[model samples]
Target: MDMRLEVVLLPVADVDRAKQFYAQRMGFRLDVDKPVKDDYRVVHLTPPGSGCSIAFGVGVTTAEPGSVQGLQLVVTDIERARDQLIEGGVDVSEIFHDATGLFHHAGEVDRVPGLAAGRASYGSFASFADPDGNGWLLQEITERLPGR
Candidate 1:
């Protein structure tokens, strides 16, 4: 079986605003923006260097706006990624790492105030949200775990 995850449909109060935030602020590539029906619009976007894409627009999802969370993007250099987002007008959080050497705690718990020594894989993170409050996390993982 060749199952692969593709697009993530995000819900937003305003389609144009969310499109601007993702395309302008976060620098995601705007792949498609077209109206299919009188009440339906589809906007597709992809992050830089990413295989997966995200879609959101009118009539696309029934989920509440700003309700999605914990979406993650893996990066090789956490600090550089954070700085780029900050420069792009995003209010990114400070770099931090998990203390237990396993994984991070959710929502500001178990966070130490620095990147892990040697920039170990799966050790550091920074987070930010879209204008609609859909949360996204940047996790530094220079190497994948065995079999991953």
Candidate 2:
């Protein structure tokens, strides 16, 4: 079972705006951004230090904005990240706790749904939304679980 989840698609109201936000504001590197056709522009971006990238476009397909959903990002520290986003004027949810201490509550993350299970093996964290109402959850792992 070596199936790799290399890419994920995200929807945005404006391609250029979203591109800048991810590339400049959020610190993701631009993978690809070019005109594909008359009404479509293919854009791909990778997070600062990750293997996977997110692809998005305008008029490329009929996929509606805020529909792609559910991105789980684990950070070394959740409180720091939350503060940064909050200082940047992004609306963040109150931290909540999952059954596991490693997971925190982010009250009603607008679009994307919750996690599956056992993500909080280390510590807990929370999330907020991007400009276009897309969801982004920052999970903070406190420690390592038992065993390998």
Please list the residue runs of candidate 1 whose C-alpha ends up more than 4 Å from where it truly belongs after superposition: none
Local accuracy of candidate 1 as per-residue lDDT tens digits, 46-108: 999998999999999999999998899889999999999999899999998888866788788
lDDT of 2 by residue, 1-148 (tens): 6677788888788888888777776777898998978788899999866778888887655777876544867666666766776765667665444543434444443322333244344445466677777787766665656762
Error in Å for residue 117 of model 2: 17
Candidate 2: Cα lDDT at 146: 75
Instruction: Report residue 118 deviation for candidate 1 (angstroms).
Output: 3.0
What's model 2's lDDT at 28?
A: 78
Name the lDDT of candidate 2.
0.68
Give each model's whole-structure lDDT.
0.91, 0.68
For residue 3, model 1's alpha carbon misses the true position, in angstroms, by 0.8
**Quick one: best TM-score, which candidate?**
1
Candidate 1 colliding pairs, count: 0
Model 2 poorest ten-residue lDDT run: 109-118
